[model samples]
Target: MTKEQLCEYRELQKEIKRLQARIEKLKDKNEGYVADVVKGSSIEFPYTQHPILIEGFDAEKKQASISRFKELLSKRVEKSMNRSIEIAEFICNIESVKIRTIFEYRYYDLMTWQQIAYKIGVTDESYPRRIHDKFFEDSPN
Candidate 1:
């Protein structure tokens, strides 16, 4: 696997988290609509029509909007999750132990170079980076 493809895992994870947050926000807004309906806050008169009927109309529109947005966010989350799984599998399949460790620590786990060095029993943080660069340099593109 190329360095660029492996490096994309961190950003995909971030996007998944962001999309999940948006889904949660949509859920919260839907709940607020329910609460507002329960509290009769949206009640208004067409004089000839029941307040309940009017409220239902407004609530349905808001509910549809929120549902559509939540559905879109959910799809985005699924796509990111699938890409993350592919990257993780690629990282796991690398034959070199140290190189795999560097990829996992740097990309999958999102660890700093210093932390990776410590984990791999090296004194210098740059050690991991050097190994990574050298591996890619020697690898066939």
Candidate 2:
């Protein structure tokens, strides 16, 4: 590969690493939030009554709800990553390096398919359908 191509590859690698770190940080935060909710409830329930028992219960409930939301976000992130990996592997197998890059940038990085198509010198109207077709073609029945 040319020097410019090598530099671009390094930049893309850095971007992917940064995104992975963000995903990890979000997952860790989600776990910590869940833990806080559990700990707060455990301390407040079935034991010596604190003065602000009702307030503690309310706080615990709110925390629990927030923790649930965080859990959902974490799960969605994991699902997205898994789907991207599957798509990337399929594209790689097809020997379509450019399309694989476009797919990763659009799906994994959360850019629109239209944006990806434009970047790859295509029109927006058929971009999503094309990608969808490629994905299903590669997917197991």
Candidate 3:
């Protein structure tokens, strides 16, 4: 795989993390809405709590919002999984063990060059990075 293509894996990982945070925020907001709904139902006049909401409309909007969020999360997770698999397959297909290890450590395991160097028994972090750079240099861009 080209360096640019392989680099996309890291970007995708970040996007998934961002999406997770957003989903968590949405869940917290949804919980607040649920609590409000429950509290309003217990009162003799529920409209006092939500003066602007029409009967049943607020609940329907909440449900639709939840369903849409779930669908978006599902599709993003699936895309991330597929991208991970593609990256794995590309790394696996490489002929050189050292090159493959570099790819796995850097992309799959999300290790720093220093950590990867230590894992491969090298003293300098530059060793692994140089190897990675050289490999990309030699390969077709």
Candidate 4:
């Protein structure tokens, strides 16, 4: 991958991490609803807890918001993965399959360039780095 593409990949990776944390928070918030702990007297309202919402807790509205947040999380994850795959595919589009493998290992699998070189059958770890550099230099505008 080009240096610009690599930067984009890392940015997307960070965004995914941030979004996953949000998803986790939403999941935790949704899971906090337990019928046993709810405050309700039988003589007042006995069906579903609606009028007597817990302070700062609107069960139905909060659940809907959580569900929407989950949907957003799914889309963001898919978008990041898809874009990364597209970049990887572009990196692989050269005549050599090894470049594609190297890019995938580096970006997708989070492997060191040296590890990629080793996996790609290069005796010298720096050889793959040089080849990728040449590839970047030779790329068209």
lDDT (Cα, tens digit) per residue for candidate 4, span 5-122: 7758867888878888888877667443443335555566554443444444567877887898799898998899887777766766667777666766776777877788778887
Superposed on all Cα atoms, the candidates' RMSDs to the truth, in angstroms, are 6.5, 13.4, 6.4, 6.8
**Which parts of model 2 have CA positions greater than 4 angstroms off?**
1-94, 138-141
Residue by residue across 81-122, what tens digits does model 1's lDDT show? Answer: 999999889878889998998998899788999999999998
| Candidate 4 lDDT for residue 26 | 74
Task: Estimate, for each residue in 16-47, the C-alpha lDDT of model 3 and write its tens digit.
Answer: 78877777777546431432223344357554
What TM-score, over all chains together, does every model reach?
0.75, 0.33, 0.68, 0.62
Clashes of each: 0, 0, 0, 0
Q: What would the per-residue lDDT of candidate 2 be over residues 1-141, giving only the tens digit for each residue?
A: 222332344345455566566655653343323222222323655865433322123456556665676576566556555654555555466456665676556544656667777777878747754765665567564
Model 1 gets an lDDT of 0.81
Candidate lDDT (C-alpha), each? 0.81, 0.54, 0.80, 0.74
- Per-residue lDDT, model 3, residue 125, is 96
* By TM-score: ranked, best first: 1, 3, 4, 2
Rate residue 40 of model 2 by lDDT.
31
lDDT score of residue 128 within candidate 2: 55
